[model samples]
Target: MGFSSRTFLVAPDDTLWRLSTSKFDRMLRDPASHSLPTFARQRARMASVVVELVASEPMRVMRTTYSVLAFDAEGRLDPSRFEEQQFALVESVVAPVIASSAEENNQPVVDATARFIAQGGRWTPSPALARAIDEAALEQRPCGRL
Candidate 1:
């Protein structure tokens, strides 16, 4: 069996502890606001568990899978349905964090993050992204620096 993962580059001023703490705190303070039918208050509490698991680790890996609706028994792609699902994930989960971080740091809006998925669910970053990751690695600050 194979699995896929997405790695987020933590900026110099950010730490997994800080990010996790902030997220946990925010969810705690506004449970009603963050709650969704699929992600209710109990589901939100799982964030603390995840934070605990990764606190002492520099990098944590989690498995993720994409959702697709099957309109046919043969499992063919439905472009419109697929696009709608992807856009919803991006808009609801991905965009807000990216936009907020950009705004906080006074960075330009990132129209897209390029992704190349190879056979067996491998991810290959573009040259520019690879360079950025390398640069970010060099700039990692001491834990709790910010």
Candidate 2:
């Protein structure tokens, strides 16, 4: 399938804000440039990676409900083939940011995923493809940490 054709959802636990508060639109609008929102920053990094991996196609999303849909090259979702794309997206985009920031904290992203999987986190692709497709916008922004 073409790059933009498949749709996926962002896990609630993996929300970008949960990764960093400095990312809060509210925070960005204000004057006090405080410490980087570490979680948000890291998550934002991961989110950027995901978009890059799933590049080229346009993604439509609903913000309030956080629903996302990507038009597959074939215009359909193949359940068996979905996870590879999902994992790759997660690994490519999200992992580096996780590696970059929380690398110091030693936060267990893989562990978290393992736990989620252990808890029966099925591979149901979300209709919402996890908004924030602008990797350029995000990558251009400086990370608080190296």
Candidate 3:
């Protein structure tokens, strides 16, 4: 039996080292937090015999399933349900077509940022990305090719 087993924990002590009635009475007088209903209610409540909840905070209940995320019957998320089908379609079809066209004609510069993204790296844009605040303001004119 495991050490956690309440039955296996409490032994008759094969010797005469039984729990003192005076000490047991003192322990009962002290404010005790309820742990084991059976052992607490019983006349003889020992440390090893009864399970004591030694925690300041309530512990989370043991989960039936190992994974934190819940899955459907098919065990996968449907892209359509999440409205991600458009993105998937663009990635599979439109993105490849545009990339091929750019590679053949434009031969676009594969800079560090582009290279990082191509290798599956991701980043969130922030106000720091804009240097317009630091740069001199352009004179107002009709928008045309430089």
Compare the candidates by lDDT and give the number of the best one. Answer: 1
Name every residue pair that clashes in candidate 3: none
TM-score of 1: 0.23
TM-score of every prediction relative to native? 0.23, 0.20, 0.18
Ranking by TM-score: 1, 2, 3
Worst 10 residues of 3 by lDDT: 62-71
Q: lDDT for every model?
A: 0.34, 0.33, 0.26
Each candidate's clash count: 0, 13, 0
lDDT by residue (tens digit), candidate 2, 9-101: 233353332223233332324314422323231212223222222364433322221222222333232223334444544555556676668
Count clashing pairs, candidate 3: 0
* Top-TM-score candidate index: 1
lDDT of 3 by residue, 1-146 (tens): 11111111111231111233343333334324212222222222112122222343222221110001111333332223222423333354455566778888977734333333222312222343111111101112111110
Q: Between the candidate structures 2 and 3, which one is better when assessed by lDDT?
A: 2
Model 1, range 1-146, lDDT digits (tens) per residue? 22222223222232221223443344335534432232211101111111112334424323323232222322222335435545655565666687899899998875543221111122244555444433333334322211
- For candidate 2, report its TM-score: 0.20
| lDDT, model 2, position 71 | 21
Clashing pairs in 1: none
Worst 10 residues of 1 by lDDT: 43-52
Cα deviation at 87, candidate 3, in Å, is 2.0
Better of 2 and 3 by TM-score: 2
